[model samples]
Target: MATATATARAATMARGSGAADAPALMLSGVGKRYPKFELRDVSFALPRGYIMGFIGPNGAGKSTTIKIIMNMVRKSTGAVKVLGLDHVALETEVKRHVGYLGEEPHFYEEVTPAWLGGFVGKYYPTWDARLYKATLERFGIEQSKRVKTLSKGMKVKLGLALALSHRPELLILDEPTSGLDPVIRHDVLAELMSVIQDERRSVFFSTHITQDVEKVADYVTFINDGRIVISDVKDDVLARWKRVSFPLPLRPEARSASDPAGLEAGVAEARAKVEQAMRGALGRAFAAYKIDGLTFTGITCAFSEDVAREVGHLAGTRPRVLPVSLDDILVAIVRGSEAC
Candidate 1:
C-alpha cells in the first residue's frame, strides 16, 4: 500500500493541479555515443499518472537511457523533458521534481540509515524526515543498522525510502527488484501501484522483468541494441501481437526445410515456403515465421479474423491464433529483427 505520507507529499510536489496537458516525460531523438555501442534516436513518452515500463534484455541501453533522463550521463544529441521541463537545461529543478533509484544504489556503507537519511535529506528542499522515518519502519529496516550489513532487499528499501522522502512528481526507478525474491518483489510492485493514487505522479520503471511490467505497467517501451523496438500501451501491444501456429504440410519444399543440408539453408527454405503459402493471407499484417520440425509458428502484430481465415484457406492448414504475452512478443520481435 502507498503510505499516506507519500500520497500527500506527491500532491504537494505536483507542478499544478490543472497542468495535465503536457506529458510527464518526452524524449526526442536522444542519442548517446560510445566507442563500441551507441543509443540511436531513442524516443518515447510517459504520460502523466501512468507507469511506463522501460524493458529490454541485458545491455539493451535501459540504464543508459535512465542515466540520461537523470542527467547523470550526458547525451550526444536530442532533448529530454521531465514534468514538462527541459531535463538538462533545468537539471537542478528536474532533480528536485523527480525522484530516482538507480539499478545499483550506492551509499556510504559505514553509516547507519539514521545518519545517512540526515545527510541525504539536507539536499532535497522538500524532504520530509517524518516520511523517511515512516518508510524505514514500514520496510522493517533498522534505522540504526549500518548499510554494509543489510541484505540486498533491505538496501533497496533504504534507497526507495530516500527517493520517496522528497515527494517528487516523477519516479524513475531502474531494476529495483531484479535480484529480489518473490515476496520482496511483490512488496516493491505493490508500492508502485499505490504511488500514483492521486493520478498526478508517474513512474518510469526500467527493468528486464516482463512479468513485473505486465503486472503494473500501463505503458511499455521495448528497447534492443540501443534502439526503441516498440512503445505503446501494454494492452494495445498485447492485443495487436499474436501467435499463429500451423502444421507444416508434408511437401518437397517443406521437406528440404528440415533437411541436414545446412540449418541456414534449411531455415531459409522453410521461411520462403511459409511466405509463399501466406502470400495473400497476410494482407496488411506483417508476420515472421519459424519452423520447428513439422510446425510453423508465426508472430504477427496485426492479427485479425480475416487474416486467420485467409491463412487457413491459403496455407491449406488449420491455423490457430493465440493471444501473446509480453515475453512472447519480445522474443518474436528480437528474433525477427535479428533474422533480418
Candidate 2:
C-alpha cells in the first residue's frame, strides 16, 4: 500500500510531460464594449515558450482584454483561443490549460492557504500537490494562516503559487506585481522566470512597470485608448520612439522687434496663411502614413526624432539627441490620449 501511494504521487507531480505542441494563446480582432468604455479592436498572440508583455495606461482596456480572453466577460466581437481551444465554445477545455492571476486577488474569508490550495487543486485535471507545497514553502507562506489575515504581498504570492501548481501550459497575470514590496515582488518574478524555463510553457502579463517588463519580456504590445499603438520586438519599439533636444538659439521676441507697429499684423497673417501649410508639411515629413489610422490628441515639440528633424529644418543643423526611455513613451501616450 505504501509503495502504491508513492507511485501515484510521483505520477501526479510529474513535470514537463504535457504541452508538447500548441500556441499558448491566440487573439484575433477582439473587442468588448461597456456603457462608458469599449475595448477597441485589440489583437495579439503568445506563442509557446515566449513571454508577451501587455502594457497600457490605467484605463486603456488592459483588464477588459484579459477578462475577455479568460472567458470571464463576453466580447462584442473577435475570437480567442487558448491551448488550441476556443475561449468561448470550449471554455471548460481552454480553462484546463490556462492559469490566471487578477490584479487584486481575493480568497475565501476564512480559509487558510493549505486548505485553499487543496480546494482549488480539485478543479484542475493535473494539479500537483507537491508543487503547491514546495511553492508555498519557497514563498514563506504560512499555509495554516487564514486568507483574511495575510498581507497584500502575501496574497499575491499565494495567488501565484496557486496558479503555478496546476502546471498549466499558459499563465495569464494581470498586474501581478502592482502593490507588492520590492523583496516580495522580486521573489515572485524570480519564481515565474524559473517556471517558464520549459520551452513548452508561456506567460502573458499586463503591467505598468516598465522595469519588470524589460526584465522578462521577449515581446511587448503597447495599448492606448483601447487600441494597440505598437506591437513588436521590444528593441524595435524603443529604437523607433526616440527623443531629441537642442538649445533654442534666440527668442522669438528678439526677432519680432525687427518689424514695425504692423509686426503683430504680419505675425497674425503668417499664422493664418501657414496653418494649413504647416499641417501639410508635418503630415508629409513624419511618414504621415503611420499617423493615418491613429487619432492623435496632441503633438508637441517633443525631444524626439520628429522634433529633431524639425529643429534641423529651422536652424539648418542636426539637433542634439536625448535618450528616450519606456517612461518617456508612456508619458507621451498619456499626454496624447485624448486624441486617440
Candidate 3:
C-alpha cells in the first residue's frame, strides 16, 4: 500500500501569508530509476488556489511523479516543493498544512469512522472535531460503523473527510476516484472544486479521466514516457492545440499550370502540402498530420494569429478547424502515428 503521510499537526492551524505567495506545488527535473522503467526529467507547477490535472496514460510515470512529491519514494535527482517549502527539508512543517488522498485509502478493519477520526486527529493539532462531524454528515457516512463495513465509495468519502478536517493549505490526490461509481466520482470532483474556494488552498489532481480534469481543473500538466509533455492553463491548451482539416491537393493527373505549388495530390505530397501550410500558419505549433483522399488534417499545438491571417490566402483550399478535447491532444501526441 503506497500512502502519503502528512507529518504535521499544529496546535493552532493558521494560514501562512508568506506560503500562499509561492506555487502550491513545484517539481524540478525530478527523476527516478528502476530496473527497466525510468521516470525522467519530470517538471511542472500548480499555482496557489487552483486545480492542476496531472494526466497521462498508464505506465506513463504519473504515479511515480506523485510519489516523488510525497517523499514516499526517494528521487534519484531533482527538487520538490509544496506550499513554497522544500518537501524534504521541511517535511513535517509542510505536511502539517498538506492533505493527501490516495487511490485507495487504508484503515484498520476494526476501527469505526469515529475512532479513526479520534486517532488521526491526535496527530494533527489543526484537526477539527466539529468539522469532521459535519463532513461525515454531509457525506452520509455513519461514524459508528466500522470502516471495513463501508462501501468503496463510503470509504473514499471518509478519507476525504479526514483530509479536509484540518483545512490543509494544499491537497495532493492520486487517482482519488479510480474505482468509484459515477455519482461518487461526481461528488469527489465537486468537493475538490469547493475546497479551493478559500483561495488559500490548491489541488494537484492525478487521474487518467480527462473528462474530470476538463470539467474542474484550471491548469493541466501532461506527462508520458517518463517525461513532461505539456503544462499550461487549461483554456490556453485547448485554444492553442487544435484539429485542422482542409481539402486535399489536386491529384498530379488533374493538375493544371495554374495549380498552386506542391498542390499536386498524392499521399506524400498532400501531407507535405498541408504540413507546409499549417507550419506557415502556426510555426512550430504544427505537430503531427494525416491525409486520406480529399481530407487532410493536422494538429497544431499553438493556434496563432497567423492561422487567421493566412486563412484568406487558402480560402478555396482552406481546411476546417476544430477544437480538440484533452484526450484527442493526448492521443495525437502520445501515439499519434500519422505524423508526416
Output the number of the lDDT-best candidate: 1
Off by over 4 Å in 3: 1-18, 251-284, 308-315, 336-340
List TM-scores for all candidates, in order: 0.84, 0.76, 0.85
lDDT (Cα, tens digit) per residue for candidate 2, span 229-277: 7777777666665444333233356336676645555445434333343
Q: Each model's C-alpha lDDT?
A: 0.83, 0.73, 0.81
Global fold similarity of model 1 (TM-score) = 0.84
Candidate 3 lDDT over 1-340, as tens digits, reads 1222221222122444225577989999999999989998888888898999999998898888888888988999999988878999988878788888876688898999999999999988788999999999999999999888999999999999999998888898989888889999999999999999989789998998899999999999988889888899999999988877777664555454355443443445655655576656343556776666667666777676676446435434555789989998888768843331
Predicted structure 1: lDDT? 0.83
Q: Where does model 1 exceed 4 Å of error?
A: 1-20, 248-275, 278-287, 315-318, 338-340
RMSD of 2: 8.0
User: Which regions of candidate 2 are displaced past 4 Å?
Assistant: 1-22, 249-315, 337-340
Colliding residue pairs in candidate 3: 8-96, 245-319, 245-320, 246-319, 250-265
Clash number for each model: 0, 5, 5
- Would you list the clashing residue pairs of candidate 2? 243-303, 244-303, 244-304, 296-339, 297-339
Tens digits of per-residue lDDT, candidate 1, 74-163, equal: 999999998777887778877887889999999899999999889998999889999999999999999999999999999998999999
Highest TM-score against the true fold, candidate: 3
